[model samples]
Target: MTDAILRVTGLHKSFGDHHVLKGIDFSVAAAERVAIIGGSGSGKSTFLRCLNFMELPSLGTVALDGREIGRPAGGDGARYYPEAELCAVRERVGMVFQQFNLFPHMTVLDNVMEGLVTVKGMKRAAARERAAAELEKVGLGAKFDAYPGRLSGGQQQRVAIARALAMEPEILLFDEPTSSLDPELVGEVLRVIRQLADEGRTMLLVTHELGFAYHFATKVIFLADGVFHEVGTPDEVLKQPRQERTRAFLARYTEFGF
Candidate 1:
């Protein structure tokens, strides 16, 4: 028996002949904040996507809360889980993207209520109540009626986060959540994420913010060339990396004063 909330084994992903992820394996315990750090083309985003089957794995098993997801049948890579099963898996694993991915046509409240009402079969009154609370959690209660177009980049991103939180997911996957914002706007989004971290929300994040990662992540995995070159506490991997590749990668960030 394992206490891990999520377990990924022998994960591999390839686009034609170009292999992006090469036999990666890791398990995330409940409430663990894992930061996946690497230079460009290191498969960080791909690895994150595979967790929720957003990008199907070429080979691997993903188990959440003890049950396996999208169990590939046979040796062929063509078979996949039915849409219904995938939907169930996704409901427990929410994602926040680099781009705010909000619906411009809908008000912030409507955007957050979409998944709850449509996918979760929530009633309008119930979903609206939940959506309002989620928005408040992200400090956006006042923007409920505002459209995405009316909000600043940071505000829009908070809407995105609130939308995900409205689902009450077991784990949150963040793919460079602050990357699309202007420099001045990144702090607000980061502050919200920090609050979630402090509240012990299980999260897996791919980020370039070294300072944030160092301060926020409980575990840091330094990936290079499709595999984790170093995995340890943030202090161990970020401050004193064991592998040359990990050291070299952090050195670049150091030069930039990150």
Candidate 2:
């Protein structure tokens, strides 16, 4: 609320006959960590994807730093941006996915450096230095030369995080960042994310980790049926929700001891 760094208005997404997101109006302030929680098929991932222009919204306006990203390119108020513009948007808004998206053939350091060198056009030596520093921050400095296949799930995910951080993005998006990791490995990844939050990185995360969400988020949004069903501070939304739908969702998570 201090001054929205990212804003979405009238957001909507559809895949043929299936409509996922419906008129979601939301915003995030600088250095604010926003946690989005909901049941499966709640459009959490699509909502995150739309922010980075990874999935073009059927109708909406996504603005970053007060500048709207896509333009009206066709009829019916349909909008989209060119790849060049979307690429520019992504440089400022980085995203990490559920699965560890690493290059199996590249060394850990190289995997982190690849985007810097290829996308940002930095020199290989400079990119290597930057990537190594990011890996060190994520507790993976010793595994610089190791390949993705040789690393544990947590380590691979840390590498993924390091890759995203090496870009020095203004905002980060995490979509179920630890969902694919072994139960034991989830903590390691979450710890790294917590460190990022403590360092004051602006982030929006889609997660089912309710307990962590309770502590990690500055603002929590319970998204259901493609709309924001509840939005407030963590305690307001997670610990004391007024909406019955939000209560039922939390009850289900509580049933699982979340």
Candidate 3:
């Protein structure tokens, strides 16, 4: 098997008039922790969405473990991704959103178990067992029956993580995982991410936490004008960034807490 779990080549995306990604080329190895950081409109989130095929690329290819993730159907008429193929690819790539996208009508356990039963075809009892284990992994075993409306922002995010984990995905994508939390709650979420990294999970994160990026990231990439302008080891990119844009961005965070 190829060591690279994710391979994107010449990826491009545009939102009508705005070109979000301009020929992005990158590869992520198994169990690698890579952080993508940049200014608000640098296309970090869009790039992440493209990885999971939530936002299809205008021109490019994304492959996971040697399999092309999404492609158009050929003239023969059969869909290249027939619905099932797309679902399978999505299953292998679990994503945790900034809003924590939990179902308001379901309990924490139910939210986690729903996908397992519906997508993976697991029995209720087995799915619950697996869900419980995942909740426990995210320190949410006690909130299994609690509703999303009742939990704090941090706890809700933990449930989201557990929900994703229940599928046992090979790779995880975190889009601004801590951006929506209260100031004091960011640490709790970061702690969960840190634990996952310590356990050697393959993760791709888009975050503004420079401190965490400096400490946890195996590689740090800086985006500018819809492209990865700079990339290097964490220390090289975050601490002694060679690009002027990167240095200026860090300056604001350090001095004014932007």
Candidate 4:
């Protein structure tokens, strides 16, 4: 039976006086693709970061495969995971950042293989093989030996995707995966993501690509003022959002004849 692969409950994150996320709650079924959209500072990125404990939540719980990750239970009370356990939880949820944070000093192949060998404990030979296959999947097989500086923004981002996939994560979190690419380059990255969804990889995406968000997502979430203002199927959320904030956000991107 299919199950919920990731669950966020009562998530509240704050940075001093600024509340970045306010009681956020969502769940991802196995192999389902979900997209999050909102205006700037709406806390989409912060929500993604909380998944892997990159940013600790002030209060809430994140569960993966039925296990409450990041947070731990003790005899007296509950606490976040220790650093070592937190590291293990992070490996299961791989993330690709908006800026394509690939190592400039490493070739594409090494960048992809680094996590496998270092974090996942795969042998170098085996990691290289996995990295190669991932690169090929992202249409970067020919660019394996190319350095980050030598490839286009789209190519570099593809390498970053490959690097995340090489870990064989159960869930992939993407923060504005194509936001930094040129207009012409956006299609390539989005196409790769479409292929991933076709293959049934669970994914959570935060993006401004409304067209892709509507077409590619099984579920759509609209965040506003650090809260999920709406959540529903693509047709419901994108085509007919019930909230005024969501309608307003979409209006800003609408093109109309003068």
Off by over 4 Å in 1: 76-79
Arranged by lDDT, best first: 2, 1, 3, 4
TM-score (all chains, Cα) for each model: 0.97, 0.97, 0.94, 0.94
After superposition, the stretches of candidate 4 with alpha carbons farther than 4 Å from their true spots are 71-78, 256-258
Q: Of 2 and 4, which scores higher on lDDT?
A: 2
Query: 1 in model 4: Cα distance from truth in Å?
Result: 11
What's the distance in Å from true for residue 38, model 1? 0.2
- Prediction-by-prediction clash tally: 0, 0, 0, 0
Q: How far is candidate 1 from the true structure (C-alpha RMSD, Å)?
A: 1.4
Q: Mind sharing the TM-score for model 2?
A: 0.97
Q: Write candidate 3's Cα lDDT for 1-258 as tens digits.
A: 358988998888888999999999999998899999999999999999988878877777888877776565665322244567668878999999999999999999999999999999999999999999999988888988899999999999999999998899999999999999999999989999999999999999999998998888899999989999899999899888899998988888889654
lDDT tens readout by residue for model 2, 86-150: 99989989999999789999999999999999999999999999998999999998999999999
User: How well is each residue in 1-258 modelled by candidate 4, as lDDT tens digits?
Assistant: 237888888899889999999998788888789999999999999999999988887788888887887545564334567898778877888999999999999999999999998898899999999999999999988988889999999998889999999888889999999999999999999999999999999999999999999989999999988999999999999888898888888888885624
**Residue-wise C-alpha lDDT for candidate 1, range 1-258, written one tens digit per residue:** 289989988889999999999999899998999999999999999999998889988887888887878656787743476788789889999999999899999999999999999999999999999999999999998988998999999999999999999999999999999999999999999999999999999999999998999999999999889998899999999998889888888888778562
> What lDDT would candidate 1 get against the real structure?
0.92
RMSD of each: 1.4, 1.2, 2.6, 2.2
Prediction 4 global C-alpha lDDT: 0.89
lDDT of 3: 0.90
